[model samples]
Target: MAKNHLLLSFSFFSVLIIAQISHIFAKNTSKSPIVIQPYIIDYRNGTVTKYYNGPASFVPPPIDSQVQSKDIVIPSPSYHNLRARVFLPARPDPSRKIPVLLYFHGGAFCIGSAFGWGDSHYVAKVAAEARVIAIAVDYRLYPDFTVPAPLEDAWAALEWVAAHASRAGPGHDPWVAQYGHLGRIFAGGDSSGATIAHNLAVRVGMGHGPHLSGLFLAMPYFLGSKRVPLEPKWFPFSPNYKVWPYVCNHCKGGVNNKFINPFGRGAPSIAHLGCKKLLVYTAEVDELRGRAIWYYKRVRTSRWPGQARWIEAKGQSHIFHISKPDDPATTKLIRDLSAFVNSN
Candidate 1:
């Protein structure tokens, strides 16, 4: 029991190290053992407390003057109910058939909440600025579960969103049913969530899911056993590789599994992406930027028969916009997204 306790403590310590990586890798590392407060990592006895949780729902006057939000639970007998934070514009034009977006938050699939400030704030901004109803799917995390589970949770939420457009879809929700365009539904995520977006897109292509008009991959978390130039190591088995398998339940084929390494052997081809439009953008300084570039290239050369574009933000870190929503780069991302979903 004592050894196990030590192991868990060490694991929590490692998470702390990751949270402070942004501080450490910079030119001058802090001499003091200062614990950065970006997140409250209270992992103990097999539970993690990722401190980004925000209000489950927000009203215009209280949260913001532009957007209002509420909570929706997608019931699932297979697992617990998945929580989705729905965001709508404060002032609505019912005559406008705007698009709808389904987003997943990133926590390496082990932590993070849909109601978290980063996801809620970003999605709310998109809903207001881009004239779309946004649903932030709060899927289950790891340690208690693994892949296909999170994927299932995300699909279920997407299905619910798509239902809003189907014959029996009305009454599903006021915002989506009233304003969501029939053909302009989309999905996106940050980091690990981006990886989920890609996988979900593939599932949609396989006749296994609903139609997605487009996908916005923000700093997608695709990894491989092989080393990329920018990657500090071979990734899956590198200094922090344990987190991957741990999040995946030591998934079959280890790090080379199709879920983690989409480009590896026995994996589905990018040529099978079902979406009509895909936007893959990454920050300049993100360690995973190289893989995002690789993903874009694969999609570019594939015969998927879709419009694909790539953008690289100069002098930015991984998911910088999520951490700093007011940044100019974040605004650019939202602007580009608005144009993409509203193009037609």
Candidate 2:
């Protein structure tokens, strides 16, 4: 009887241990970390990659008199259509064609839309104040669309805008009809959107010559590699952070070849960019600061007769200059960006 009782006690303890182990494993498996920092990849190989968290729908703020926002649709490659928000100045002089600023939102290629507060809201304000036509593009995101899908969408939108600009206005110069000068096309964005901006500029430059007059990137993540090459103060390892190959695989449900990875694809050649100017904004405390800085340096050192202006907030971090209007950094960013647009 004593032996049996001892055996029973041992068996109970063993079962408890097994149960605990199983529970732990189940918990981890269910909530696995999505953004794992790569261990071996050297981020210096010109890879600019990052990830974004899934987004929930957000209600926009109250509309004001400064800008008029309208939705427009464009055709997509997959027998579908994409949407965009056109922000036009309230008091427009029909006689003069305005320059179009093609803007993309930054949500790490996941949770952003063309009409988001960061991109659309700010661009509208800038357009109205600076008198530029702002077209905030809403490109398709990942998991539903794969790598280059977003890029393709961006290119298509550009072409669509260029093609339709003439018809968008009456008596307006066909080339400058919709948004002023076709040669004055300015592409810009923040975060992942910035990546797209740089990619589009590079591709256009590499091809027949860029239709873009300038490229503006704010805290741009132009790499597809894993590690961010910096010890960031924020949620660097959060599930929202991701790299290429891994992100592309996860996004498309399969691994894609490395040649198409923009950042890892190597530094873009400046000769193809022609004479377009570049405006790169960097946050002092952003995780991708190193990459942005690196890009700025490369562009500044390039052979192109373009200008590279770097605006680093003294005490601002990633997205810090975007949110909360009361913040001084945000105010500074607005001023700087507006000035850049006006000068360009």
Specify the highest-TM-score model's number. 1
lDDT of each: 0.78, 0.65
Q: Distance from true position, residue 79, model 2, in Å? A: 2.4
Which tens-of-lDDT digit does each residue in 121-155 have in candidate 1?
78889888988888888887754677868888878
**lDDT score at residue 14, model 1, on the 0-100 scale:** 97
Which candidate ranks first by lDDT, i.e. highest?
A: 1
Q: What TM-score against the true fold does each predicted structure earn? A: 0.80, 0.75
Q: In model 2, which range of ten residues has the least summed lDDT? A: 252-261
Q: List the residue pairs that clash in candidate 2.
A: 47-223, 48-222, 48-223, 48-224, 49-223, 49-224, 176-180
Off by over 4 Å in 1: 1-62, 77-79, 167-171, 234-240
**RMSD to native for every prediction?**
11.3, 6.9
Determine which window of 10 residues in candidate 1 has minimal summed lDDT: 31-40
